[model samples]
Target chain A: MSKAWTFGENMNTDEIIPGRYNITIDPLELAKNVFCEVKPEYVKNAQPGDVIVGGQNFGCGSSREHAPIAIKGSLAKCVIAASFARIFFRNAVNIGLPILECPEAAVGISEGDDVEVNLSTGEIINRTNGRRYQANPLPDFVLKIADAGGIVNFLKMHDIQEVLA
Target chain B: MGTLIEEIFSRRAGGTVQAGEIVLLDVDYIMSHDNTTPLAIKAFREIGKPILDKNKIVLHLDHAYPAPNILAAENHRKILDFVKEQQLPHLFQQGVCHQVMLEEGFVTPGSIIIGADSHSNTYGAMGAFGTGLGSTEIGVAWVTGKCWFKVPETIRVELSGHTQPGVYAKDVMIHIAGLLGMDGGTYRSVEFGGEYIDNLPMHERIIFPNMSTEIGAKCGLIAADDVTIAYLENETPAKGPFERIVPANPRYERVLEIDVSLLAPQVACHPDVDNVKPLMAVEGLEVHEVYIGTCTNARYEDLEIVANILKGRKVNPLTRVIVTPASARIYKKALKNGLIEILIDAGCIVTGAGCGACIGRHGGILAPGERALTTMNRNFVGRMGSPLSEIYLASPATAAATALTGRITDPRGCL
Candidate 1:
């Protein structure tokens, strides 16, 4: 079980990882600055396996893969938002960051709640309030990519030319 | 029944493809810029394969041009080393990748192109399936010459009537973005129809797809017509013939129609592209700076319009105005036409052809609590320097008028 970090809607990429710190593409370097501006105490308070919850339209700006890399590197287990911007959604999948779309979990879960996620079932159980929420399940193809730790690793296991062809 | 996007995918797939279907497409061209190219090159190296085709790849140095600092300079050095080693055919140090791609004839009708930058959709003006992709995807494409796509549903936007004087395509796009919320067209394709689109020149046609990404559309498409043929002949005559894809009895999931004649000079208020309002509604708000450039609105005609509006007039002493030509060629043409001189005489700061101030990196960084009126798209918070500063989006006419008055004044009566 992990504590929750709640955020409001329309949280853009700049806020997640401000453009100023974007000079480096190193995931570990980027992780240090994740949510630095909007949530300065994020690094100090966030423990491993903590979850991030946001309202609608989270990660809605520049197509920076660094945003997900930073989040995943920050030791957050996964992100739960009502909805995500298209490019950000794709980036998360490409980088192996687990994200769920659950409007109920986004609004109902409070800060510091102990929540558990079941990737195969798309279930989010709120142990703090004894509430449950359902997430949109991923397609089998997408799941395989996620399970293999992202597109690059997944590609390593298959003949990209034949699989894509 | 297939939409224009579906038809393009179908043709590429050698069969009939529909919306929501995933297909692997052979990319005609793929590009990456300074900030993203290093990552793509690294990934490409990890693949341990020779590039699928060097001629099909392009590397541009526009994003961090003139390098903001020593670190940025180092990053440029790395990209240059990779390009030299790989023997990439096309490398541009002169202008934004999108503008250079079109002006140099890299884009053709019925082709599929993807770039590391999000605004790559600008190529849709030439009837190509151009869209943005992540650096890894671009890396994968560089190695394999293929990328996957889930064909998106189409939104038919039928524009009718002629544009009024001083009202430009920039205004029409801002109006549409406001109507469709910021994410309204998410994961969909926006196709243009009706008389207004038919009458638009190539520069104006580029504006629709250039800004379509702001509305969250996968890509914006306009079918090739007589104007497209004329543009290709005049701009890229050396290129050979290419097939043009037009949807046969296209089926759209939704349709939106707008009359251009009814649109007034419009502005997307601070912080949101969707918070659009008529110039009349927000007139007289003080502005500290006025910037005109970027792939969205900076072209020869754009500068010409600004020169026409600012002729014999000086910018407000308090309002600093900066004008940038989209490409070096356009800048030379504007100089030949005396537009550059006119702008300089009117107290405008003219700069080289590149993305100067749009990304908040260099040309004109705003101070906290200051405000600017610009022709660049995307005014998200801190997009142009200070997070406390605000950016107002408008057309060249509106930008010129605002520069002269030191306030958000309507451009209709100025000209």
Candidate 2:
């Protein structure tokens, strides 16, 4: 069971990861700086398995890879949003961050609600109401990589990294 | 199944690429700009190659030009350091990559163009297959002359009817983003056409593919017509035959059409592309800044429209309005046309053109609590330097109106 950190609609990458600190290459420093500019509390203290739910086009502007990398580093197991900007979605997947699209979730869930999400089945159960919703589970390929702790590890596990090398 | 541009670029992509389709594509033309080149040059050397073919590449210095950032200035130093070492010839002073390519007579129709910046789709307006890439991937491609692509499905966007005055291409793209919510065209190419698009001026038609990335499409395309030819002739070595591209008999997976005749001011509400609505519905929203420049809408023609509206008017002192042309050429033309004076006299600051305020890269950045109304693509949160500062995405006319009022407004004010 994971607690939902229900946020308002349209939580952008700057709210997730600010841009001023983009020049740095250190991932830990980046993780430390996540959302400190927009939501100061999150960067300083965010529990694991805490999912950030947002509105459409969550990531926009500047093709920065740091946006997704920082979010993943902060231990947001996944980001469930109503929709997403194209580049951010691709970057999230490419870097192995889990971003699921849940269009109606905006109206259904509430802040601080306890929920159970079965990643393999895409089943979301609201602990408060004991109601359940079908999550339209990710395809097998996504699950395989997500299970391997993101795509890079997936590539290493399946020996795909050898090809690029 | 067969997109006109894809059919022409990778002619061999169709038929069948099954469960395991490993294909090698001989990249036609590759491009790199200031920011990505230094790192790319490093990667290429590490990978062991001078470059597969010099002619197949274009090195642009557009990103950090005029106002060189620390990293890009370092890149410029490297470009100068290896000006002859790399044996490259596609270098130019930092300028807008899209306009520079067209003016220099680079990019031909049905050819593939890849650059480090995502908006490289600007060339797709000229009918070239252009897209963005990361530095490492570009460096590898420069050495190998090949890059792998998972063929994307195509979505046909049938645009018909004439636009109401001042409703230009940026409005049309915003309308599309509103219609097909952001993420609607994930991993797809938006093939554009219809009677409405056939007659737009060259600069106006250039806006479609420039911002397709807003809602997420690889590139946008339109069939070549007379307007394209007339514009091509003025440039260097005229382009080859006008490759007329026609939609398949049945047409795209999904067809969405917008009637420009009756459409009114539409705005992409703060934080999302699809948060769009008729302007009358959400008028009077407050804003802190208004920007009028981007690869999408900062051309000479676009500036001419704004200049007409701001001729004698003054922007609200409460609102910081900045207008950046897409290129130095457009800036010069604005000066020639007295558009620059109109902007200055009317309280608009016309700065050197190079993607100003669009990405908030260097020029003007807003504090967290501020809000900005812009004419460039994408109103995604934190897009214009402030995650807390809201951004309202609209047409140049609408942006100008907001500039005058310091609030989200319709440009029908001047009218």
Candidate 3:
């Protein structure tokens, strides 16, 4: 089980990692500052396999993949949101950071609640409350990419031309 | 039968596909800037492949150009070294990546372009299927020249009626943001059509798509028409031949009809782009700085609007006004037309053409507790500097007018 970190609606990329720190592309360095402003203790307190739960339109601003990179670098297992912005969703998938769209899990999961998720089955269980929820499973191709550990790994296994064809 | 995005995707997919279908298609151009290129380069190295087509890749050093710190300098050096190593032909240090892409003729109608920046949707103004991707995706595209996309359902925004004298495209977009909320067009393609969009100049038309990200849209497109062609001919003579695209029987998931005939100047208040209100609601709120630039509204025409508002007038002594042209080309044009002089004479600090101040990497960062009024998009918390500072989004006219009063004043009142 993992701890849940909850955030309100429209949590933007800037809030995830301020643009000032964008000078560095190092994920670990970026991770140290993740949620520094909004949740000052996030980087220090968030443990491996912690799940971030957010309200609607989570990750709504800038296309900085650094946001997801920061979250993943922090060793968070996955992000669960009521809904996600398009680019953020793509960024997370491209980087192999698991994310789910389950409104019930987003609202029902309380901060510091013990949570468990199954990316393949789209199942989220709030161990604290004994409630389970279902998320829309990712498409097969996207799951394939995620399973391979991101688009780069997926590309290594399959020829680009063949993939397009 | 299909929306504009569906048509573009069909051509690339080589088959008729609907909104929910996924297709892998070859991309025409891939762009990345200082903020994203280093990460993309790292991913590209991890992929262990040579660039598939050096000609199709474009890079810029705009986000924190002229290196504000040692890390930025190192990143710039890395991008430069990679560009040299790959013999890439499209490295541009001249301006913001998006504006430079258009000025350099990379964005063509009915083409598919992806960038490592969200505002890549800005290319949709020319009727291209432009969307943003992560640096890793850009790295993958560098090796493969192709990416996958799920054709998005269409949100048809039919804009009618004429904007009032001081009302501008920025206001129209802010109004749309107000109506749609932040995620109104999430995972969808928003196509702006009808009389209002048809009548906007090229510079103005670009604002719609540029700010589309504010509404969580995948892309915001305008069908290629005579206005688009005319702008292309005038601005990008070397651009390749392209066909104008318009959906014959486009299907839409939802339709929003907005009449701008009597619209007032609008502002997106602090911390949220969707938290919009008419100028009257936030009038007289003091601002410490007034910024007029960004891909959203920093075109030469937008500068001209600021010039017209500031001509023979002076900015409030207490307010600091910073104006950045979107590109060096725009800076030169403004210089040639004496807009630069007008801005300077009005006490505005004119910065180099780049993404300066907008991303808060360097120029004009706000101090703690300070408030700013800018013509840029995205007023999210800490967007400009201190987390406690505030950013209010408005038009160039409103920015200039506010610069004169050091407060949020309606441009119409000044006019």
What TM-score would every model get versus the actual structure? 0.97, 0.80, 0.98
Give candidate 3 regions above 4 Å deviation.
A161-165
lDDT of 2: 0.69
lDDT of every model, 2 decimals: 0.86, 0.69, 0.91
lDDT of 1 at A117: 87
Mind giving the per-residue lDDT tens digits that candidate 1 earns over A19-41?
Answer: 76777888878889898867879
Cα lDDT tens digits, model 1, B104-200, are 8888887899998778888889888888877877888887888888899999999999988989889999999999877887888999878999999
Lowest summed lDDT window (length 10), candidate 2 chain B? B13-22
Model 2 C-alpha lDDT per residue in residues B140-256, reported as the tens digit of each score? 677667665555667778787888775667777788888876667655677777777887887877877777766567667765667766677775465567665443443356777
In order, the TM-score of chain B in each prediction is 0.98, 0.92, 0.99
Supply the DockQ value of model 3: 0.79
Best by DockQ: 3
Model 1 lDDT vs. the true structure? 0.86
Model 1, runs deviating above 4 Å: A161-165
Candidate 3 lDDT, B1-415, residue by residue in tens: 5899998888888889999887889999999999999999988998998888998999999999989889999999999998888899999988888999999888889899999999999999999988888899899999989888888999999999999899999999999999999899899999999999998889999999999888989999999988898888888864657688888699899999999999999999987888999999999999999998888989999999999999999999999899989999999999999999999999999999999898887889999999999999899898889999999999999999999999999898776
Going through the candidates in order, their DockQ values are 0.53, 0.17, 0.79
- Report the number of clashing residue pairs per model: 0, 0, 1
